[model samples]
Target: MEGTEKPVSALGIEKDLNDWLSVTKSRNGTWWHSAFHNVSAMVGAGILGLPYALSELGWGPGVTLMVLSWVVTLYTMWQMIEMHEMVPGKRLDRYHELGQAAFGEKLGLWIVVPLQMMVQAATDIAFMITGGKCLKKFHDTVCPNCKDIKTTYFIMVYASVQFVLSHLPSFNSIIAVSIAASVMSLSYSAIAWMTCIHKGVIPDVDYSPRSTTTAGMVFSFFSAVGDVSFAFAGHNVILEIQASIPSTPGKPSKKPMWKGAFFSYIVVFLCYFPVAIFGYWAFGNKVEDNVLLSLEKPRWLVAAANMFVVIHVVGSYQVFAIPFFDMVESFLVKKIHFRPTKSLRFITRNLYVAFTMFIGMTFPFFGAIIGFFGGFFFAPTSFFLPCIIWLVVYKPRRFSLSWFTNWFCIIFGVILMTLGPVGGLRQIIVQAKQYKFYS
Candidate 1:
């Protein structure tokens, strides 16, 4: 009877469209794919802000926060990988799917989807601004005598690339892009810190707080934590990355996924630590929010670094955007019951890219946006959500190490999520007073 029944209902149709448009449809990714994808996902525009974050927090607190974030986020990332295939034969292909497994269906969607969407969207917006800014930097350095161009035009050029690439379907389709982005991330990160070391420490550098008032110091500390939190933000894309790998009953995707994630974290450490420490050492409290902006003397090297940043952000943009495209297409096809066609995807994705570009052009507060969104949504998704999901699903023993660890992360993340915005908002307001939109 069941075999005789038609799989032609509205629900069945929705499922089919979702599968067709889903970013995880191509399950051919390998461990190396995971490695580079993770790298591209984690090491983007945020790493450039580490020195500025250190400047705000000073030596002790800055180092402590960076170290703590690395350890905690890695542990949480491992938890996500392990839990990916925990349900005997089922794979939690999306972050929201895992959330649904931990919490009941509607509640899970409510909690995870909004946070995950915000994190992905915010990162894309940040990348747009970063790519545009770096492009402007490259232009300025190479042709100092050339007439100046507004940053808005550069940002539009950056978004135009995405409009073309966004047509690439599935996570695996963009492997080449992600790989190139990953390499560029490592390359530019090296250039940033190495250039700083070459420049040497500034004369009579001040290591004290940037702000004199106690309130200002405290707020900057909060914003600095947000900056550090922003640096380790690959967790949002982990499940989607894992979904692109093949899995079977004998050899689940988690094994290769974990291997890739482990090695990626090593790369993450290599990229993040040196940039924060050495850049801070070189510039002290006077370092620009974007370290690339601070290094001016060696024109050619700085120009190359800026170009590398442009390429890296261009590649990294898709790593975050694919999931977003999936979300948009799924909504249009499933909820609206629209037919899945190439035309539908082209229009939707192009519009999304244009929207982000417009926003980036409007409010290009690179550092403030990083700190605000990093704490506002990135904190929950990257820092503590995995731990919370672990406890909810696994019910780790009371007073056990797992229990204590999860709780500690939850507490720390909540504090970051709460206070990070306060500082970031104040900074944005201060910057806004001096900024002219689309100028």
Candidate 2:
């Protein structure tokens, strides 16, 4: 806000840029359905690791950080929507287009596209990893003596399922999948929460520092920051989710977008806190990266929850990935002169899913992958970009509260990017030593 740029409208680039945004095309849907879609996208594999994440800092610091992430993400969601609203005659469908509109083509092309792709790619990989590992766990419980199902094989199998379902032509066609994914998410969350309660709080759990020395303590703190930040890294999907809400013909309806998103955030918050807290309380510091994995007996319920997770991730991956697929498809058509056809969409999306699954096979440790993406990639996509767009577009006065908050977002994002990646990389390195490819 302290330093604003010349408005894009004045440069007459508005009409030219509308080409990209129009691809997302405004669609009509009920607020609740849109809310369900948002919730579905937000509550994927992230929640599975949330307990371990929260347990890192104990309840107080953990809950505090979770709330802070929610607030900041919420504000940024509004900021992105505001930018879309300002472009009076356009449908700024996705994040990169928003960047292109607000900042310039270079950021949209070089920075936003790649960074956002990295985040989504990481997310899909995490999904594949989660699905594979969950299946492997199920296999182990049902038959201990049988040959272990490899994570890579399970991931490939799940990827095949996605390849079939991914044929749905557009975001509008995926509505049913979204609702199903949301319901499954809620089911597993409730099961996990109840399971934690039944298991009861672990006894004599140490809430003190995991590290003795100051340096070690700082490392632990930074690692915890990365882990916790991973729980709330769904910011990239918001603009697309917001764009899907039905608009009135003459005037876009902000009501549906706000109402839907707010309701969904409520759902997200309610589920996130209890699962994180109670799961930690139940398992203590011994919790696995996936809290569901922490459960020993009651094998049936855990299996059921894992089953739900697998199904949900399949759907969730598509929602998170379709935008990236759209981006790639657009680039191919524009730059490479490929025809935009239904067959091309089918090939591109399936290919993208296959590539992510391959990455998952290589990096099977889900927790570390989550931290890496959330730290390095999502920090800016989630926090920094929205603030920049808001500051530049709104031009809040220097030294004013809004300006400070905007700057704070930028600074906080930078700190998270720097410290978070360090923490995340540390996790990846630590986990890598124990990792077995396709195990």
Judging by TM-score against the true structure, name the best candidate: 1
lDDT accuracy of residue 243 in candidate 1: 89
Write down the lDDT that model 2 would get: 0.76
Candidate 1 lowest-lDDT run of ten: 14-23
Clashing pairs in 2: none
**Model 2 lDDT, residue 254, Cα:** 65
C-alpha lDDT (0 to 100) for residue 234 of candidate 2: 74
Candidate 2, residue 82: Cα displacement in angstroms equals 2.2
* Per-residue lDDT of candidate 2, residues 134-159 (tens digit): 77777777676998667788888888
TM agreement with the true structure for every prediction = 0.96, 0.90
Per-residue alpha-carbon lDDT of candidate 1 for residues 183-287, written as tens digits (9 for 90 to 100): 998899999999988899999988999999998899899888888888888899899999899999888888999999999999999999999999999988899
